[model samples]
Target: GAGVSQSPSNKVTEKGKDVELRCDPISGHTALYWYRQSLGQGLEFLIYFQGNSAPDKSGLPSDRFSAERTGGSVSTLTIQRTQQEDSAVYLCASSLASSGAQHFGDGTRLSIL
Candidate 1:
């Protein structure tokens, strides 16, 4: 796809399980971001990756959440020991540069049981 792509559009899992969400950004985009949107809530930044610089993970809510962008392209967000509160739509976006406009994916909806 020419735009950002996220896998497993919907995920339903037990509360205690772990889940991995994948994001493939637009080719040649040097900046990628991960965000979460809960029901009726605005998007919350989770992580950011710009080129080879260290990823900005300060937005992550807890240690259980982590993400990584590999080879400056595909990125993955992993949630360990999922909880009901973790349920939300995970959105992926990419831009030509950190300050450029970003293109977003449809997002992956996660449901915790």
Candidate 2:
């Protein structure tokens, strides 16, 4: 893809159900990030993987949320035991390196029923 790509533009699930969001960044990008945007709220950092270094998971809200970037390209975000509060647009971004400007995907909108 020419730009960042995300799977399942929209997802609706009952509370307690788990969901996984996928992100495919621009080829050759070495930095990948995940963020969440809630209604009327600004983007909140979730996690990021930079090269082969250990991923930074400090931004994750809880143990239920986890993300991983494989081979420095595709990334996945998993939410366990979903709750209504977890509803949000999950955005993914990538940069050439840790300090480079990021390119973002359209995002995956998750709804909890």
Best-performing candidate as measured by lDDT: 1
- For model 2, the run of ten residues with the poorest summed lDDT: 93-102
RMSD of 1: 1.0
Instruction: Kindly list the per-residue Cα lDDT of model 2 for residues 17-36, writing each as its tens digit.
Output: 99999999999899999999
* Clash pairs (backbone) in predicted model 1: none
TM of each candidate vs. truth:
0.96, 0.96
Q: Candidate 1's C-alpha lDDT? A: 0.94
- Residue 57: error of model 1 in Å? 0.6
Q: What stretches of model 1 exceed 4 Å from their correct place?
A: none
lDDT of each: 0.94, 0.93
In TM-score terms, candidate 2 sits at 0.96
Q: Write the per-residue lDDT of candidate 1 for residues 1-110, one digit (tens) a residue.
A: 88889998999999999999999999999999999999776799999999999999989999999998889999999999999999999999999884579999999999
